[model samples]
Target: MQEKIIDDKILEHMTLENVFKIINDNIFPLLNEKEKDFCRELQEFCIELHPKIDKNQDVYVLFPELGKRGYMQRINLWRDFMPYGMKSEILLATHLSCLDSQLELARLASGILCGNPTFQHGETDEILKVQDELMEGSKIGCIGITEPNRGSDAVNMTSTCRKSDDGSHVIYNAEKVFTTNGPKADYFATYAVYNQANPRGTMVQAMVSRDFKGQLITNRLKIPYVDRVHIAHTIMNEVEIPVNYILGDNGKGYTNLFDGLVPERLGIMGSGLGICWATLAYAIIYTNLRQQFGQNIINFQGVGFSLGDLLARTSSATALAFQAATSYDDNILFAEHPSKEAEKWIAGVSSQGKYLVSKLSADLTYTVQQQMGGISVTDNTDVQELSSTSYIEEVIGGARNIQLLIIQNALRRYSKLILS
Candidate 1:
């Protein structure tokens, strides 16, 4: 049998063209439509503009729109163009092309935060970038560390990577749960504990492409709305990939995970800020337009006071999210971890900001829904959608409890500084 060879340009074009089309036609149109609808609804409801909320909502609806708009043709261009950009000069200089440039990666992360299915939708690009070899029409890459059994504890992974004597390949066996983009990913950045030497030694990061035999199992996760976010699971049954497919050094996968998580946390915080802004905007409009006792509700001291409190919270949350983003952007330049002291402070602040905004969004959304009275419960009502989304924001990308734990951990590290 003749070995099949993959053409780089063909792969690149297939990836980039599809993504570009998806974004320009599907994502952008839906964004514009939603923006117009949301703005008009707010105006009719007499609400103020909330950029963060607007951006987040735009992201949530972008996935289906990409499918609808047939823009998958040019989706991979950003991934290809990004690594060579000025921001990623250092990474590009190293001749690394497996992962995207930092800016491109950031853009992709941002798209995901906004609920765009760039990861799933741009699978072709993912494969071209991450995998060394590719087969035609292959799906893109995915990250599948999280599981139904082990949530945050990556060390407790049940997956195992066993090396063969030939040293040509490694066999991977594990069941991964809660995989985002699992169903569609052609390749996977999979984390598994290698048990060849000793079962309790260290974890290894391997690149497992879909060409290797594996099963994508869909477990329907119930959310409040049909248009809610999507997540999935993947079962790897003795999947095989080249021995060279390992990422970083063996046993250092956790470090990579930690480094990656900092940015992920910041990204989630940004989305939360957006949700908070949206909630406050909704509350402001509802309080003004709603009438009780023959006068607008805003005229009532109680209603005005509640809205004022939410506005104050929104402002504080915005400031915190901004500060955290700034810190993260700056830290990207530092080769080492920002001073442990600084890291602790920033982590604490970011966690607090995320939690505060999440809570405020939830409270404000509820208050606004109540102010809207009977209409708030209906699916057609804008307030209902806004309220439901607020809850989604609270749970997605690490919940309030998780943020609190992060804050507590950071605070523990800073205890001596405070005492001094």
Candidate 2:
């Protein structure tokens, strides 16, 4: 096999279509025709829905009868892809590109991967009948894990879960912060520390309803650039749910919860890749068409270098992300009790992929925006909106500090991989 390196001028000269085809050929060959077509529709739909991402209230315009639901339900991508297992990670990134933020992907994954009753096994679950209502887009869902004071340290949580007198149900109480879809989610994959006898406890995750007595979103806040999507903090005050509602109720709920994290991180990787690809595309077009000094700006070494740098970072991020995804698909997807070494290695790859992509997104977008000059800041410029939103991507999955923490943890837990 002859290897063709995509250098600065090579990428600069190539058409966007050719670039994407290369991406398909190498990184995402697993994407089938049906999934490709769905991505096209989603991209076209989002463009049509809010052609100009900024200064548009269209994102807030809900489907007439769907309550708070947006176009995700109208398209039915979740229902079509949720049950597929490993492939859902790839499709999720495709989905996030059209959608504004990683929050939506994480929220949907929380429901589809974690909240879905069938995630535990092959048996039929009555909960499936209840969540079937979600297929239509009438309901929104969220996953609650991180508290305001503690994010990385989730195991030593203060939240508590206690069994009722007859053991028919458990009471869940926690102040879950940075919860995506928190304000509007009708169902939540919530977690609390169990073992009332001890002040400190291990994790216990559950699926809780919105109508529970003490359930409330409490406050609403907007994340910059993607302000149209709601982000909120929530509190569960002694919320009670039937024991059956518990997800991964076994003593090892934390282990089960981890099965869903891969998809969320992969989804963020997809979003970052999309942002850089778009930024690189815009930079290429602008430099080619926008004349300076009687020649195109792309001819200049400095401008070309910036574009090349963005291209290099974006491509690297894609490679890392795809490697992690494919590794999971092939090695970890069906493996039960994967060795600690295998788990640690996968975690390292995932963290590195996510961190590099997120940091690259923020850097790439900002550099391209600067290259475009002041005009790039105008509200109508797609580059400006994308650049601004790319900044938000830095903290979407995890804050940069937390990303560093993940990297450090990976090194400590899997020194063999790092030292190799």
Candidate 3:
């Protein structure tokens, strides 16, 4: 066989159409007709958009396209997009992640991380304008909660803030790290504290625009895996934000910060779940076609069984993510009167699901790479890219240890309920 023919034979299975077909075949049964239609629409969009992407360019370049389609964020009703809720958001994240994990990461940061605060806490015209800009992708956004000294200890932040005498402006002096999309963001949904000793009592959450007439500086951090996605080391020196831009001030910032994390983690779960499915789908396609010892490699007991194990685990994680999203939608996002009990339950479950799925994304990608061999490691296939994304999954949206800590804290609480 000619080399061209051979290359075509192996590469054909890795096409977006085939991969989407596989994922759709597996998961569509779980979705209703409308949800399935949404998936198909995403599939078509991804299929069309995938080929045009410049791998070296910034992911933000695609933000306008996402905004046009209401793909920037799906959790809230932005424009006329239907089925706007947590589950829809999850599906959107999943499809985007499968299409391009880096783009999805940047979108989540801009759309959900930054834009979400506006929806959740913003009550002023100024903040709403920023929200519209972010959702429309006319302006990019990022969150600045994680600081140099505070990774998992997010609430007790050292970044300081001061309110003006007239109370019309809040000044922030903060150095934040691990800020995804920060370098290119036009607005920052950032946090700071008035008193370090009383962070919870004095924290402030504000939407700081890049042109806010303050020294809001950002330098891109070298996260080599998702080079298209910009993570930043942000330094805010006397950045003065108008009081109206403050989403949460005083002790309310602490509450708002924690409130945002549940959905943020759930969104990450959606992204990780996509990585799992994409890795599995691509590996499955490649293994079933690549020949070894005069037989397709997938027929071998070792490869087949390993794929089986990954399949089962990915399906279970998908179920967990979908269920959590559904419950969140029912009890929180779309709730007329949100159920406190369900809220409490979903919070714990989000931590648990985030922990499981994030680790699973890393593990399964590596395992599937091993199963698919050299082609997977090369750009000839997407396994290597998926693996790159997986490596960061455990670290983002709070590290694996933080998720475990949340789960453990929830476990400790069970003692009181059961004992009572």
Candidate 4:
């Protein structure tokens, strides 16, 4: 094949379009005729859902069924439209978009209300089946991992899990704080310190369904800009799950947790990339339109330079995210141990992407808002919402500081590898 060299400006435009096409093309082809029709329905529903994203106000109206029926319908539609593997890819993309939506809402709602809570019920096989069903309908599911005292240090969890005398059931007791979708989740993936007869280890994963005898107490709190979702402080008082309800091998819950983390990080990176793209698009339009002196504001060296920098960073971040996704997919296909190098690169790139894109997003939004002057502050203006939500891109998934930690860890590992 001949070497092709594309100009920087053309490459930038192509990259932007390509990222969106990746999502649209992957998602659209998977649908059959009926599923395509269902997708239209979902698109309509999503349009309605978008406005309600300002706060938790619309979740009840939008997610009334709150069962497998709704989620499964959507998941089925998605799967039917996309290839099997592509379904998962597109699902991740949809979730990234949803997280961006949620993060936008959080920005508007923060300080006006607290974050949304996870629903109180635990995860069960039945619930998982239901969730699988509902996932076809809905792309998002919330699980509570953080407790009051054990935020980052999940291994030091104080929650206790004890087996019944005959080992027929297990009782769990713990308090959970800051459970996202806490008051609204269909089911919860809960963790506790399980004490078995042999006491092989600490920690276990349990599925808790909403119907379980647990409480979803929405603690009243104020967030800024938007109304809060039903975030709660939860008490799991003697909740019993059948012994078989364990998500993985007994005493091996930590392994499962670790396994899940890579995907979770990838999901976060995807969201960050979306935010970066949105911010870039916003800046491009604003800079081209806003007039300062006799020419468009983009004519100024400072403004043009900033836009150029942001554009480059956004493109790079997106490429990193795509590469990570591809690497993850390949690793799974080959049943190979995840490439330590790839993982490290992903961790580093994702962390940098999160940081750069987050900062760039905020800067671009604020600058664009400044270009609009006072109108940017008005609640009714689209830019106003965009500006308010920009800060949240940094905080979601992992905070900027956390990303820095990940980058440092990756660097240390890379250096050790070089020396060894």
Please give the ranking of all candidate structures by lDDT, highest first, separated by commas. 3, 2, 4, 1
TM-score of each: 0.64, 0.78, 0.97, 0.70
- Alpha-carbon local distance difference test for all models: 0.47, 0.60, 0.90, 0.50
lDDT of 3 by residue, 235-333 (tens): 999988999999999989999988998999999999999999999998888888889899999999899999999999999999888999999998887
Which of the predicted structures, 1 or 4, would earn the higher lDDT when compared with the native? 4
Best by lDDT: 3
lDDT of 4: 0.50
What local lDDT does model 4 show for residue 191?
72
What candidate 3 gets wrong by more than 4 Å, as runs, is: 1-6
Residues 1-420 of candidate 1: C-alpha lDDT, one tens digit per residue: 022232333223323223223223322332335333432332222212111123223233333322222211221223332211111221111111111111112222223221122322223443335422211112333566676687755557788777767877777787777554455454567777776344235666666767765453545344434133344567877777676556533566556555445544555454444444444454454455556699877888777777677666756655565456546545532426556666656656656765776677678778766655664565322445555555655654566787888777866977799889
**Global fold similarity of model 2 (TM-score):** 0.78
Candidates sorted by TM-score, best first: 3, 2, 4, 1
**Number of clashes recorded per candidate:** 23, 0, 0, 46
CA lDDT, candidate 2, residue 135:
45
